[model samples]
Target: MKLLINIVRWVARFLGIFLFLFFVWFAIEIGSPDLDMMSNQEVKLFIGNLIMLMGLIVVWKFEFIGCVLLIGGYIFFSLVNYSFWIGPIFPIFMIIGILHLFCWLADVFRIAKKISFSTRLFLK
Candidate 1:
């Protein structure tokens, strides 16, 4: 059980980091290439997003920031790249959301198990 929990947590953390970096890369692509073509506001917005997503990873609270970044990135990307807006990219957000979800799940399960164990011993 402990091993499984550890594995899940590790996998989740990796996915979280990967997705966050993906966001930063996408943002850079948008803000670069044709720097002169991109508006100042667009450059600022992309850079701001990159910084915040990286911060979320550094803070290790990938859920909140990851979810927001995923959704925001998808919508913004769709708007910017209207041609490639086919199929479902919501799954990307779902995957990141699941990673964050499992992290919380592990914490909740551990706490619950601890509480139950304590209750049984205390009652005896």
Candidate 2:
């Protein structure tokens, strides 16, 4: 189980890295947007994308926080765009966030179990 959890965590990390690079390349190809001329929706989309990217980068150090940022950013983007089914990319990122979440949870539980076991041993 621990091995499986580690595998999932590593997979999530790699996916996050790949997605981050892909987005960077995509943004470079698309060129920068004119902030002054962008509509409110466009601005929101830009911010959402920024948040998602930041999450991906931060996830390397903080899994739980990063997953929250990633999932929240994607949801914000979907809500602002009024299209939850925009494409597979957003959903795939969301899945990656979920995977990170589960890994974090597993680590948390494992730590808690060890602490409790030690406490019980001390008590006995």
Candidate 3:
């Protein structure tokens, strides 16, 4: 179980880093949009991307919060774009978020198990 958890955690970390860098490169290639001229939807999309990017950055130190941000940002972006099927990147990030969520849950359960064992030992 520990090995599995580590594997999942590391995989998610690598994928997140790759996605972050890819987005940065893509943004640089495309250049920045004029926020003053952006429509409401475009602005929303920008915000969603920012949130997702922040999630990718924060996930390095905090799993659960990062997972929430990633998933939430994806949803926000999808809704703002009026479509869920925006190529593969959105789904890939969603999968990464799910992976992080699983890692968080595993850590929580492991800690709970240890605490329970210690409590039982103390009671006896």
lDDT of 3 by residue, 55-98 (tens): 99888898999999999999999988989878878777888899
lDDT of 3: 0.92
34-58 in candidate 2: lDDT tens per residue?
9999999999999998999999988
Better TM-score candidate (1, 2)? 2
TM-score of every model versus the real structure: 0.52, 0.95, 0.95
**Which 10 consecutive residues of model 1 have the lowest summed lDDT?**
82-91
Superposed on all Cα atoms, the candidates' RMSDs to the truth, in angstroms, are 5.5, 0.9, 1.0
Error of 2 at 104 (Å): 0.4
Give lDDT for model 1. 0.58
Ranking by lDDT: 3, 2, 1
1 against 2, candidate with superior lDDT: 2
Q: In model 2, where do residues sit more than 4 Å from their true spots?
A: none
- Candidate lDDT scores, in order, read 0.58, 0.91, 0.92
lDDT of 2: 0.91
